[model samples]
Target chain A: MKKFMNDPETFIEDSLKGFALAHADICDVTLNPSVVTRKSLRREKVGLVSGGGSGHEPMHSGFVGKGMLDAACPGQIFTSPTPDQMMEAARLVDTGAGVLFIVKNYSGDRMNFEMAAEMSENKVAMVVVDDDVAVEDSTHTTGRRGVAGTVIVEKLVGSLAESGANLEACVAFAERITGSIASMGVAFSSCTVPAAGRPTFQLADDEMEFGVGIHGEPGRRREKIAPTDEIVAMLLDSICEELKPSSGSEVLLLVNGLGSTPLSELYLVMNSASKWLNRREVAVARSLVGDYTTALEMAGISLTLCKLDEEMKIHWDAPVHTAALRW
Target chain B: MKKFMNDPETFIEDSLKGFALAHADICDVTLNPSVVTRKSLRREKVGLVSGGGSGHEPMHSGFVGKGMLDAACPGQIFTSPTPDQMMEAARLVDTGAGVLFIVKNYSGDRMNFEMAAEMSENKVAMVVVDDDVAVEDSTHTTGRRGVAGTVIVEKLVGSLAESGANLEACVAFAERITGSIASMGVAFSSCTVPAAGRPTFQLADDEMEFGVGIHGEPGRRREKIAPTDEIVAMLLDSICEELKPSSGSEVLLLVNGLGSTPLSELYLVMNSASKWLNRREVAVARSLVGDYTTALEMAGISLTLCKLDEEMKIHWDAPVHTAALRW
Candidate 1:
């Protein structure tokens, strides 16, 4: 509950100033309003811009560097960035090649990024990643949702663009990754945003909610504590059924820690995933076990798997340089 | 806190499986125990290996890819990888050029990595990074500690080695970056590792601690909550004085969240950091704002700064490919 800030209002602005000051090699900040973009002046490649509420570091902004996003419009903590900011980023990052907006499948993010993409003069391609496999849509809402799978789309499309692929190619690549990737998360405890000064949601000492969202959104089902293997099986079963990649198709597994799960726990979940997949004889080509994308200090882990072909593999291996992710 | 694991002992292995599956293109997992390595075989370049407990994801394993770590040894959750695992990793990653072990400044990590380095007959060099500015020698039971600053060392040295720097030169470069870098963190709450199933430490709602280590290790002092500026001031006063980089010296700043802190809170703190450094006229060459190194959803941010010269900047900008960090 303790936070360091002069005022909640100035938090985003001040943080952007410091972030801009430090990452001059790869990023620059826009004035008057506020936005982040790669330092490259040409903007010759198909510009890819992404943004959302600010709490997720490295996601919207940390991805702005070579082989990734051309720009990112960062918003207030857990709040959507203004549409105007996204438009400015679109203008700044657009090369003659055009621009693309990668968005998580959240109501606020979808609405904002989509609005910006439509309003901007630059030829814009918009892709919303909705790969969370945790939720089963009710008649009132969309099935599943976007969570950590957003990062996979960014990586896939960013690398394609960096390799001189055009906007169309980038869009196609983004779609492919989005289709293949699936994520499911569970939360042991709710995270309290500093300004909010309280837990987002309440959980008992011995309970956990399966399939939680990043913003502490409600998930499909709540369950009691279970063995890591059972949890992994539940998550993987949901994702595999959703993705349904052809048998023997290679897959990339991501065991993501919600904010609070320790790496050890993540590892335990991943071990279950490996055994489960091996038993099925599924070829897991690569594995990423860590906190790639996180839910604020929620003690849980999400499993994301992206089915891959040779092209995706090449894209995944391409060199990249960003503050949060570098490979 | 509820956790997802069949047994405490199986966490690391499962997680590595998920990790390997998620990044199949860039990494390969060995089943006969567990070790992850880059797919690109480099026979002539000196291989770099680092590993420790699983809780700190992307630290040792997530970093294994091009232009960074070549291989990572997996240990049980919150436990150091055995010397045998490290040796296996060293041997697997080594090319004719030699191998370098980048060990964080922790007793277990140092001892394990050192033993691996010594056990291997292949020419190997080792560099231990102890850049946490918070751990004053006076209070430490043993020696200086490593915190978030290890990321900078890993990236810089990884780039150098990838570019074919010799073992000694790589060690020297890592040493140089480690010497120039300093980091300090503050935590509002203690994190609960899943297996442990309890708070690492307890804090009153109104209390906070400065100089916290990443593993929920207690800092030197605890104090009542102060204004953001005052809190940041206390941190800077300790870290800046400890670093004491000359005025006008170029510095790279990293404002890192400890897992749970939202971007809004981090930004607020960074505003204070920017104003403080500007008041001192310290030249900031660059900065990185995000969760580069985190303590399993601890609700806080750490500030890291490194005095930078032309060489450091060159390496800083170099391309890298890894699971957690890319570019």
Candidate 2:
């Protein structure tokens, strides 16, 4: 696999400089040998910060604006951002109103963000988003994992913070959204990291992996390419059983395209999902279909659903602004 | 090339459903087929609608919501949205305040959106963004093409619209930003469409394509990989020449990663760009780096710069809320 770069080693530093320059209204940078934090100031509003691997653009950093993260820590590629970086962001965004760390369920992310929270001087609230229903349903998995569903929790909670809701309110709102959401992903072919210069995993052309991790880690099962309906059924069955929302509950359905999957294929998956849910009489009040949280250019898609209440709907309606996510 | 979908044909449709379900606050779908429209009801606001091929997520559709597009017409993967679909969106969002079409500078996109605009109500206004410096610099091209820079124009213009600027004012602002911006892109490998199940084009292991189109089409030049500084120099030379900003003019730089390029690599390119610009005494007011407009995870990046006037900076800072972007 060929890739584009002058020198692979200098990629991160160059990208950060460009990010800071383009988003000067919202993001600033502090660079030393040690840490990188996007300016996390929301004035007198309570701040929110999140960080992890750098590959997921529009996540930690792209979200550093109003109605979202006050600051973001950039890690090296898919590796977790350093605790020191998160701590710096925590310090920068803490306006005495406090700061909330929106961490994914990944072990590395949890431990690092938690450490940063502990080291923070101002009040630090922690919310871990473990919304991947796929991991919990896998008979062999040790614990539930976080995936694209983490984005929803961040948005709901971020809006609360942007509106000057207290830190405790933001944390509770984040946790609540986390519990109500679930996600599952599959990959057709592994993405080749520019630095790695090859696909992350090997799969036959006719085979696809289900329950795959975003970073290209091995998933629970690898199987032949199934029909769209079959694939959607399997993914939904796992997610539905995990969340077990009642029939009358309003659900926000997400048919997320993994990095390389085309929107056409994603829409087909959504068709299947809508049909299946309709058959079950599940009321989907609203739906989002796009590449919200991506896994490089992996050719796959994930399904995320947030069972909604009145409050969740209101929260969802609130305005939001970030580089990649706007509403 | 391995891909994730069970069937390549279904990728776009499946992805759209998920996208619609993922973020419901700013977007909703029309059932007969699939068209995403904004939920924010600003009755007197000029509705902006954008759409094209499906591969460039967070582009036409992801940008639908308040402070940006009022609706997004999604077409099949890599194909322009149908004129009929565009007409439908044009009709739905036009609430007497008239409608504006923000189209990219692609032959298919230009023709389709133009046809749609003509077919729709005469009150609709249309603007085509042609801002890619690479396409313009190549005399062989028909006209300067639009790429990621179109997004900046959309955001800046959209914010102006949301701030209650009239259609003429918004269109004028968009035109100015478009005039001030320049972009160039390079790719290492061709992206494989899921249905095609192969690379879009072939690349030798050490080769890179410079001045490539957004769909991984062949670039203006194919050469062996070089150092990061040299690469940055090449891109900056093109952009700097195209945008002859007055001495001491402020700039907003965007270094965008094509799908699979790592953020680390993007940052490296940004750093090189900054040093190069600083040596020339260009004032960098803002910088944005990440995967804004992607080509199905192609391992490459593009650089876009907007010469900022005070008004442009204010417009850029105006709040926006869209499904895939919020600021």
lDDT of 1 by residue, B92-157 (tens): 887799888887777787788888788888788888888887765523225777777888888888
For residue A49, give model 1's deviation from the true position in Å: 4.2
What TM-score fits each model? 0.82, 0.80
Q: List ranges where model 1 is wrong by over 4 Å.
A: A41-49, A65-68, A93-129, A133-144, A153-182, A250-254, A285-293, A305-326, B20-54, B62-129, B133-140, B152-181, B193-195, B262-271, B286-294, B309-326
Q: lDDT by residue for model 2 over B18-59, one digit each (tens)?
A: 566656666888745568998866877888888887777667
lDDT of 2 at B33: 52
* Model 2 lDDT on a 0 to 1 scale: 0.75
Residue A21's C-alpha lDDT in candidate 2?
58
Question: Candidate 2 on A1-327: residue-level lDDT in tens?
Answer: 543445557556666775665555656777752343434455667778887776666566766666767777777777788778877777777887888888877777878888877877778888877777655533222477777887787777777787888887887788788888988888888877768988888999778888887787777789888877888888999889888878766788888776656544565677788888888888888776666676666778889989998888877768765655655
Worst 10 residues of 1 chain B by lDDT: B134-143
